[model samples]
Target: MVSAVPECGGPGDLPAPRIVTDLAHGGRWTSLTAGGREWLWHRDEPRRAGVGPGDPFADAGGLEECVPTVRGTPDHGDAWSRPWRRAGEEESVDCPDFRLTRRVSAGAGRTVVDYRLTAAPGYRFLWAAHALLEVSGRARAVMTGG
Candidate 1:
């Protein structure tokens, strides 16, 4: 059975960007892919010590101020950052958390966005990469792991 994919998006701060931290996959970033190239949390590198699977991302950070942004460099940004650009005059959100505010540009035919997720009082969740790629169909045809 095919799931009802939300086409117009849900209740979120539209025209804005944010970090998407899901402890569901043990704090591992989930994904949203299209045209072979996809976007998700944690693309190799390293997972923050306490930011691994099952640990509530925001639950680790305190007072609603956790996570980080990755710009200037891949590791420079935080756990997750997704900017909600104007989607052709549409108002909808596909991301989870609505906290990311930084917007970086693309130079290598790829758009790199960085963001974060906070929990309680000093526990910050760390993430590495979530790239938006333009993979060819043939390449995507044999993809296996992340």
Candidate 2:
């Protein structure tokens, strides 16, 4: 499914976020209402081949790289699972194309990571790989799907 990037936020050496470029891609996860949740952060550019623009939101069962979910192991094909929580900086793991950086804030109890839809050129669009929080049965998920 091929598409073009709108002229409004055309693709280029895309502008970087004020404090960090991570937000321009996805964003930081603040609070988790549940053990699982999902979100989509719009990109200023266009989507890539694997992930098309205005694409639907994906959970644990969606495409491997299209979303971010905790797994028991680091395997790409593994299912989502609970991750161990520690402190301080973390070691780096290699990914095929995507570049991910996870930084846990000891002061704020929040995490920030940089996410990209596709590791191709001239491609940018809304990235749903942002921080996702699952809510309990009684809670509700609400967002203006604009």
User: How do the predictions measure up, each by TM-score?
Assistant: 0.23, 0.26
Model 2 root-mean-square deviation: 16.4
What residue runs in model 1 are displaced by over 4 Å at the alpha carbon?
Answer: 1-5, 8-29, 33-49, 52-74, 79-134, 137-146
Top candidate when judged by lDDT against the true structure: 1
Indicate the residue-level lDDT of 45 in model 2: 27
Candidate 1, residue 25: lDDT: 22
Question: On a 0 to 100 scale, what is the lDDT of residue 90 in model 1?
Answer: 23
TM-score of 1: 0.23
- Distance from true location, Cα of 82 in model 1, Å: 14
Candidate 2 C-alpha lDDT tens digits along 35-82: 123322223323322232233332322112322233312322111111
Off by over 4 Å in 2: 1-88, 108-127, 130-136, 141-146
Tens-place lDDT digits, model 1, residues 1-146: 11111222223522222224333222222444332434332344233333421233322221121234333322333332222332221212223333333333322333344343324566443444433433456554456797
